[model samples]
Target: MVKSYHPETLEEALKILVETHCIPYAGGTDLMVRYRQGPGLVPNFDRPVMFIGHFPELTAISEKNGEFSIGACVPYRDIIRHPHTPEILRQACSLIGAPAIQNLGTMGGNICNASPAGDTLPPLSVLDATLTLRSVSGERKVSFLSFFTGPGKSILRDDELLTCIHFRLPHFTVEGYRKVGTRKANALSKIAFAGFMLKEKDMLSDVRIALGAVAPTIVRSRELENRLIGQPVAELAELMPDLLKSYGKLIQPITDQRSDANYRKTVSLRLIKNFVLKEES
Candidate 1:
């Protein structure tokens, strides 16, 4: 039998996690690989595992007041189907992997895995999403922006569990996600970009930009976007050179098996330029 605790309720699950210090098991897509034992043998985990994948408390998508709450175990397919999911988020989830993986991968796993290349991150970053972390003691909220400490690391505590994600749609006339990878599908991204631009009467009202797989964590610069806000959209052509140069200083991509730093850097700037000056290129 699988050596995992299948709790009947969220409270029991949290209690098990705290007492046994067991790793929370959801889809086990990433964890299984990370802890793989062999071709046919069950994955080896250092400790007991708590299976929370089917708990209704962690699998439902619902809304209250003005905010939308997506459970931690909610799959990408569910997110893609939800009418309330932001277009940017939906696009990111749609391209995370093939349909099979999407059906099993949860945003909680993507987030808790904390890989810099995790596809959902850039979209969630720009969305200004918050995660609800629950412990037997109580619960508190954490900003997604500050959740990740570095590649493969996060601020989530040992006794806590990420229960849900929260976000509200913001006004943006332009929204898009652009990813550069070896293959169109089922490939890790060399660079991923999520952009949101709000322009009014040809004057830029707001700009939100996020880049992933180029830094320690998902890269978002409110400072850079603010500089472009309130500027004439037509004059973006004149401003882009300097803006791109500033971005060049902000992102740090390392050469990896998938791609090199120079190529990743070039493609990132081009994608950003296209988003900002949609009319020109």
Candidate 2:
């Protein structure tokens, strides 16, 4: 039998989190599958389960102070459809799954779960997103890049819960997102890439590239990004091989059921080059 609590206010919820030592449940899309399956199927759940689905504080998404505040419980479908959300996030969310998963899964749940293949994460990483983690005592902010510690782990503490994700809108950001799947929708990414590049007056002023399923964590190709900076994007198509070389050095892929290391690396570079070419044109 599972124990549940519905705390109306965040303070009440935090208090309950402390007192009951419960593993907070958000959408339960991931947790429910595990709870029913058995021990090896899911991570061990020593604590009781606390439901935060209906918590009023975790459901707000609005703009403030030149940045957007995305509530932890806000579903991917809503984020994709919201007029105020950045296009990169919306585009990523659209490819996360069909309507069913998007309607039920959430940005916070995705981040907190820390899945390397999480569709929304690479986009958020390129967007320079930050997470707000809160507890009864206080709140702290952490960058999206630093938040994910490993494949299925995060910097989040036991007593802390993710409150909101925040990001500043880029002035000349071109959003590019692509996923490699067996089919178009509702397929796990063999490898996925999201990028934001700025090319004004034919000069590559800036670029951010992030890849999922190519590494233990979502990786930002800083070396490739630096080499691409200040170059004429019109000429970048010729530099694709060198860029791929740098990216290949940075990413550590693995042979898994979904795909192999070499294939993952090849496509990772190809996708970035493709997106860069498209953005420049």
Candidate 3:
């Protein structure tokens, strides 16, 4: 049997999560569907679920001191529509699913689900997002890169809840986001890519690249980033293929229902290369 608890306050929610030792569900896009299909959403939970949707603490997106703080329960629609949200995240959100899915899915749910094919992870990785995890005990920040251990896995303790995602709005950065699926939207990505380029006086000074679905976890490669930085924009076309090859070396994709390993590997490279070149121009 499944037990449910809804707490109106953050402290109350945290206390319940700790007391029950249950999984947290906000948007329920992934959790409800998975639970309906099987017992796999969160397996073997001795405690019931603590619903944070009603918690007033986790439902806003606000900016302060050059950083945006996104409450865990803020739906994708709200994030995409918010005037202050970054353009890359907005574009990614628009491609997430249909209007209803967009309205129901929250950014925090996406992160905690920890799907490699998750649409928003690559964009968040580019932004160097920081996660704020809370429990009855206290709260702490975790870098996005170090947060996920694998598919459906994260560093978040069972007693803890992800409260907010905070990150700086890109400055002097040209952003790009792309996802390749069977359909334009609402299709799970076989391969996805996102990047941000910082140019100084027409020269590439810094670039961050993140890829999804091609790896067991969403990943950003420092070597590939280093290879492209300091190079002239004119050379990106020639350099793209090699960079893709390097990216493949970094991530070993698997054959899954969505796509074959070969296609995912090749398309991801092509997509990243194309996106980077487009930003360069």
Off by over 4 Å in 2: 38-45, 279-281
Question: What is the TM-score of candidate 1?
Answer: 0.96
Tens digits of per-residue lDDT for model 1 on 1-281? 44689889999988988999999978888899899989999887889888889988889998766588899999999999998888888988888878988999999999999999999999989889999999999999989988999999999999999999899866688887987888868998999999888878989888899999988889898899988999998898899999999999988888999999998888888888889987421
**Model 1 off-target regions past 4 Å?**
64-66, 279-281
lDDT of 1 at 176: 79
Q: What tens-digit string does per-residue lDDT give for candidate 3 at 1-281?
A: 67878777889888887777777888788877776645554444455877787666789889988889899889888998899999888988999988999988998999999999889999999999999999888999999989999988899898788999999988745777888898987799988888888877767888998999888899698877999889887777888778777777877789988899988877777767766776543
Top TM-score prediction, candidate number: 1
Which 10 residues in a row give candidate 2 its minimum summed lDDT? 35-44
lDDT of 1 at 45: 84
Q: If the candidates were sorted by their lDDT against the true structure, best first, what order would they fall in?
A: 1, 3, 2
User: What TM-scores do the predictions have?
Assistant: 0.96, 0.92, 0.92
lDDT pick, better of 1 and 2: 1
lDDT of 1 at 100: 86
Q: How well does candidate 1 match the true structure, expressed as C-alpha RMSD?
A: 1.7
